[model samples]
Target: MKQYTIGKKAAVIVLHQLCMILMVTGVFATGYAFRHDAHENIDIYTLISLAGLVGSFVSLAYMANVAGRKSEDDYTIYYLPIDKVYSDVMLVIFTLLMVFMGKVISGVKNQHFDYASLIMTAGTFTFLFDMAFIILYQSIVRKIKGNILCTHSLMYKGYELLKRVIEKKDIHTQKTKEIMRIQEALEAISEGALDTTLNVNEFHGQQKKVAEAVNHIRQGLMSSVNESLKNEKLKADLITNVSHDIKTPLTSIVNYVDLLKRENLENENAKYYIHVLEEKSQRLKQLTEDLVETSKITSGNVKLNMQKLDLVELLYQTGGEFNERFESRNLTIVTKIPSEQIFIYADGRQLYRSIENLYTNAAKYALENTRVYVELEKADTKAVFTIKNVSKNELDIVSNGNVDLTERFVRGERSRTTEGSGLGLSIAKNLTHLMGGKFEIKVDGDLFIATITYNII
Candidate 1:
């Protein structure tokens, strides 16, 4: 099959159709000669040739099928291994039937099933059977390499699925039954399933080890998760206390800066120092507040007051509030909101923050003098709030792909002068999840799109 080029594959198909024509004509000619009783010294060469011709047709059909069933130019992509095997088996059966028919026709044309006809039938079956095995073996062997490479074998596939559930931090939902079952098993173990032991009866030998390892890994993962969660709580407590601790002294500095500004200082440089000190102190204060807020939001410290709210009205309000900021950058807000008021179940305050972060993010980073698009779309049960804009800085795919972007302090740029603590998107993402919504971020060329999808009420 590999020897056959694209043109050859097509040519083989055409040749198979020609063989069918010859087989039909041979059957009719043999029939006509038998009726006239002019079959004396009958030549059986044509009958044998027709058998070989049908065999060739079957072979060509099998080759054409294996190559063209997938994306035409590629051999690596196969739909199903079992289906291919079944087809090969069927082709062999059909070729054998054709050869048997030729033998039967010869026996009938010549008087009785004599020694020659018997020899011909046995010879045809023996030769064709060997050919059948070779063809079937080749078809199955080709699939073995690809299937093994993808870890699709029973044991390998199960092992790989378990490894993923154990190693990956965020457990994603899967749609496949086998993987999904394994995922659920991991969850059961993580959630303190006392029977972490896999049934040794169900799996044998090394496969049993894989199941045991999955259970072992799950136990270890649960322990790690519990410890990390404790540490996280302690860290959140520390951040909250530290922020409060610094706030008291930071408040004193602000007061002193304010007092110094009111006093008549003879030195202009001294007054200038006070102004700079005030700005730095204020920025630190803002950073502390953002940190404490993000920690609370992410760690489930913040209580969500979920309620039904008009999404359209919220968008309008958020847009209107940022009108001045957008105007400062000479950026226009292009809205594609639905005409009617669309309501959804969510924490109004949190949803406002999420929408505000997206809008403000676009307004700040969007190319100056360009338009920022805010569209509200609903399909089936989900409602989408999408905002797209051209970034002011170069949007690197490597950075975007590697970084979660929703993780705390994971900024796109290394520079601190970008006017954000980089907690904006993180906060928005967490808040959305807290309110039972999905958030997605995509970067293409200079365009940045952030979409938040939630169940429509």
Candidate 2:
């Protein structure tokens, strides 16, 4: 299809050139045949030639228009310095030739051979042919290099240089403004202002693209955060409802299990089974209570009774309570307490529970015959409490190397063979936070460390 179109255009251009040549030839022939007194009486041959000349000239004009339209469609003609120079030179040559031809025609005698007129006519025809050749040559050059012709133009280069020189400062100022705006938007996002949006229309080019991209990121973050919050709320609500519903049935089961244990049983197997049922029912009741507590803490529905409490006394009490459990596993307890009392403002019940959870974690996971270190010290205006223990199993296998221990239901034992609901660390961490304290857990090889810090009062 493309080849056919090219062939059609080539045929049209050829016809146009032929018409131009014919028109030029006709003009030249009439000028050559003219005599000084030819205007007095017109011959039949002259009349026929004149009519042909007018018809050909009309055809040439029409073809020139067609060629011009084709050129305009394919190539853009820029009037550059070179074009101006070429036009001026052509005008000078044509003017000189026309003056010389006029002088020659005026000097010719009437009814003679008219040699001067013939020479002038030939010269005019040659000039017209030269003009046509130059036009064709320029058209080819413009077609090949049309796109880059402006860049190559001296006038265009000068204009560009001048424009840059005049607008350099303005460009720098605009760029600085765009950078500051982008930084401001990023800072706002970092500070949890997801509602902030960048105006893309105020920027141009690459800056505009950057602004649009930032706005998209901000919107995406807003959506993600909202979805996460909604899901968290839903999870909390589900846990709360389920725990409440289970409590009623669990109370009846506990009461019945207790009643069965009290009644005398003749079958030894039945008595053993009833004992097992009582233990399992108690475990289930404790698990339900933990779930309810966790839901309340996570949903920010729990209250704290903040008061001044001694960190040293809390640590001692927690250690004493866990002494028997640690001894059962052949784990030794080492205490590092400062002599001076360090008091912190926090909820006493919550703080004790947080410390108790740490002790429980150490007793459950610590290696047998290993020493567990418990410390309470005052540092500057803060009271720090820490517990470190060596695990019986590989820390990597227990928590998969990097799983957060404080996440709900995340336990150190992968097989979950240990007696725990896996909510101890989570409850502890949330309780510490509620009492305006910091909680962190670190695992290194077989070593596990849990630290809690609060502002001293």
**TM-score for every candidate vs. truth?**
0.56, 0.58
Top candidate when judged by lDDT against the true structure: 2
- lDDT string for model 2 (1-457, tens) is 1122435545554554455444444444454445444543335435644665565455445434433234435543443344443333544555676676556545432224454555455445545554555454444354335444355455667778878975564445777788778888999998999999988989888889999999999989999999999999999999999999999999999999989988888999999999888888888888899999999999999888988888888888888989899999999999999987888999888889999989988998899999999888777888888899998877643446569988998777665553678899999999999888999998887789999999988
Task: List all candidate RMSDs to the true structure.
Answer: 12.5, 18.4
Model 2, position 399: C-alpha lDDT score: 46
Please give, for residues 1-457, the per-residue lDDT of candidate 1 as tens digits. 2444557655654555445444544554555456656585236636744775776668665664554234444666443444343444445665776687668556545654444454454445445443444444444544553553234344555777788885573454332433445556778876877456565455555555666778778668778878998998888888888988998999999898999899999998998899899888888887788888987985788998989999999998999999999999999989999989888999998899898889878877889989999999988888899999998777655455666667777665444373777788888998898889999887777788999998888
Steric collisions counted per model:
0, 0
Model 1: CA > 4 A from native: 1-215, 264-267, 396-401, 415-418
Question: Cα lDDT of all candidates, in order?
Answer: 0.71, 0.74
- Assess the local accuracy of residue 169 in candidate 2 as a C-alpha lDDT between 0 and 100: 40
Q: Candidate 2: what lDDT? A: 0.74
